[model samples]
Target chain A: MSNRSHATQERILAAAETLILGRGFSSTGIDEIVDAAAITKSGFFYHYADKNEMARALVKRYLEKDNQVFTDLFARADSLSEDPLQQLLIFLHLFAETMTRMEMTHPGCLVVTFTYERYQADEQVADMVRQGVLTWRQLIAQRLATIAEIYPPRLEVDLEELADMFTTVVEGGILLTRVFDHNKHLGRQVLLYRNFLRMIFSPDPSR
Target chain B: MSNRSHATQERILAAAETLILGRGFSSTGIDEIVDAAAITKSGFFYHYADKNEMARALVKRYLEKDNQVFTDLFARADSLSEDPLQQLLIFLHLFAETMTRMEMTHPGCLVVTFTYERYQADEQVADMVRQGVLTWRQLIAQRLATIAEIYPPRLEVDLEELADMFTTVVEGGILLTRVFDHNKHLGRQVLLYRNFLRMIFSPDPSR
Candidate 1:
């Protein structure tokens, strides 16, 4: 793709992501993205064949951006805290801060909110969402594995299960936050997660 | 309300609930509910001042129905399994079954899917969803309290936390299931829930 064409495509994806996050996938249209990007209909199709293609690009680009964004928080968390347990808690808090800001403007997750709509109507789009979540799951699992390595006695812990719980709870918290229009519910979720981690990491009571 | 009118109104509410679940609130219309119920538009207005009013009725009715449904399942689970941990596992199993069926018909929560849309446009409907979730949280908290009382060395797990986690995971599982259009993700969620409960109940290995 030419440099100009690539810039136009980037503009189109950026606009679509904002719209999809705000209005949801079904309610948003390609024309709206094109309009938001200040590009014509012909220009929109040159970048994306259709709305589905745009959605796929949006998911892929969003995931890449998020991965880079969170990596800084994770590294800061690790550098600032010597204890793995503390690092985990701080990492989660930072994640929530970034997440809340993103959601303050958009009430819900694009992947989550659109997942159900595509599940029955469009298989390829649905697969993108599924893969996105699995990618999220893998990231969490890696963190858990690191924690388990640091705390060898925590043999009872299953990193995969913990990762799943983390992902689910985060998504759940987002849903509640949007539904109630309050960040308190999401904060409560963070508190609950921290407590769960405490249970696993604290010196065994019998020790 | 007259007996005939009450019956017609109930039918309309049920039809609205199913349609809202299947197509989402924004995509569904008052006319569709009337058509589904075989009632006239005038009758719909007589029963419910507007779509929001009908949504309120559906949420209230769903809460009542859910209470009865869960209570019956809990009673059966308690009778079949004397162990508190076993009861928790059984509950997860039952949750999975209900979720799978709901996905076959509609992939997201009627309150959640619509609440995201209406939260921006209608405060009245947003409060309706908040009330619905608060009622559910109370019901689930009570059940978790009862289970906590029976667990050994209980450590006094937080009932509110458990309820929040339960609610969160199910919603997340629904998101995953919808994204994948598969039952395995939900099944995995049930398994993870079972493990989490067992962790709370099982004897501390160090002990």
Candidate 2:
């Protein structure tokens, strides 16, 4: 694709994501996306064959962008501290800060939206969601494993479930934030998770 | 309404909930709901003027059923223990057990589903969702306030945010459970939240 064509596709995907996030995939139509992207129907058909194809492409792009964000944030966190626990804590602090900085309510997650409306999604989209969730589990559990090697947890901890807690809190926080129309809920939940980590791994309970 | 008419309305609501939970409010048509309920299109119209009206009714019923469940569970916990902290702990334990007993992947929450598909919902539906979330927050926060009075948390905690954590964990857990096609994730998350409560409120670090 030429530079202009690629830019059009990007605009289309971005518009589609916003619409889908707000109204869900089944309710969002091709005409609306084309209108929002300021492109013709032919321009959309030039990129994605159908809505399902668009959904697949959209999900792939979303996961890639999400993965990149995590990689960049954790790299920044790791650069600041050598200790695995500190790195995890710094990463969460940075994350909460990011949420706090958001100018708009965090848009809902596609994986979550798709999961609830799974009957409308194709098997390929469903498989991608499952993989995306596992990827999050792997990313956080690996960090927790390293932390566990050094500072034996005060309580018996299932590192995988504990790792899943980060994703859980954020997912839940976003839902609450959207429902309440408040932006602070997500950041507060992230900080609460941070406190949970401290109580579990810190030698001094007072900390 | 006559007894038969009430039973038919109940059938329509139950069928609508299942279809909407699976396919979302915008995608699940009245035709489909009437078909699922084994009623005529006119029958559906007799009970609900339109899909929006059905949605309002569905949300109202869901919130009430949810409130009753929590009330019964906490009451059971209270009857079992005089200590507020123990009652909170027992309540969480009971909540986890309920998730574990689910024969199917827990059907997703309507409040969450509607929140994501808010563009398709009316203002009344949106207000109900906001109120439902606040109810959950109030129920759990009241319990936490009682616990904090007795034990004095080791960490300086925001009781409201902490109460929201229970809803957060359960909401997130349900999403993860659906995405992963696993029954155990929700129960595990509830148990983890229970552990976090123990860590926060218990006087002895080792407990």
Candidate 3:
């Protein structure tokens, strides 16, 4: 694809994602996407053979972006602190800050939007979402495991479930934010999860 | 309404909730709902004037059922303990147990389903969802307030946000459960939230 064509595909995907997030995958049509992208039907067909292909492409792009964000945040957090637990906490703080700052532009997670409409999604799309969730689990659980090696948790906890809490809080936060139209809900929830981590792993009981 | 007609309405609402929860509101057609309910198209129309009315009715019925469950669980927890904190803890424990037992039959939350497809929902439906979330917040926040009075939290915390965590965990847990196809996720997440509460409110720092 030429530079111009690639740009057109990017625009198409962006438009599709916005529409799908607002309504849902089943309700968003190719015509609306093409119109929003300022492209023709042929242009859409050129980029995606069918709606299923487009859906697959959309999820693939979404997961890649998410992976990059997590990677960047963790790298930044590591640079700020050598302690694994502190790194994780710093990452959560940074993430909460980012969510608060992006409230205006944050359309919401496509994976979640698609999950609610999974009955309409093909197996490949479903698999991508599942893998995306697992990727998050792995990323956070690794840090928790390292922390556990140094500071055994005061309470008996499942490392994996605790890791999953990061995703769970974010997902639930987004839902509350959207429903309540309060951007701070996401940030506050993350901070609450951060506090939970502190209470669990901090050496000083008072702290 | 006659007894038979009221039963028909109940059937239509039940079928509509399942279909909407699966594929979303925009994708689910009246024909499909009627077919699922084993009723005629006229029968559906007789009960609901249009899809919007049906959506409203579905949400209303879902919220009532949820309210009843919480009420019953809290009542049971109260009978089990006099301490506000203990009652709250027991309520969460019972809730997790209920979720685990109902894994096979739990079709997922309709309020969440509608929130995802809010663009396709009318104002009334949206208000209903917003109110349902607030109700949860109020219910949980009341308990937390009572607990805080008895045992001032060691950490600085917002009672409302703390209350909101209950809804947040359950909502996020349901999402994980659906995506992972593991019923255990929801129950485990709830238990984790319960643990967090223990950490936040327990008088014994060691405990």
In terms of DockQ, which candidate is strongest? 2
User: What 10-residue stretch in candidate 3 chain B is worst by lDDT?
Assistant: B112-121
**Which tens-of-lDDT digit does each residue in B1-207 have in candidate 2?**
499998998999999998888778877888998999999999898878888898999999999998898899999999999989889899999988886775264467888788878634499999998898889889889989988988998898898889999889988888887777668888899999998888889888586
TM-score of chain B of 2: 0.95
Residue B61, model 3: Cα distance from true site in angstroms:
0.5
Ranking by TM-score: 3, 2, 1
What does candidate 1's lDDT look like per residue over A87-197, in tens digits? 888888887777777666655676776664555555666777778788778876877777777766343656666777777787778887777656655656766776667
Q: What share of the true interface contacts does each candidate keep?
A: 0.48, 0.74, 0.60
Off by over 4 Å in 3: B205-207
Candidate 2 vs 3: which has more TM-score: 3
> Model 2 — interface RMS deviation?
1.8
DockQ of each: 0.41, 0.70, 0.67
Proportion of true inter-chain contacts also present in candidate 1:
0.48
Off-target runs (Cα >4 Å) in candidate 2 are A103-106, B103-106
In order, how many clashes per candidate? 0, 0, 0
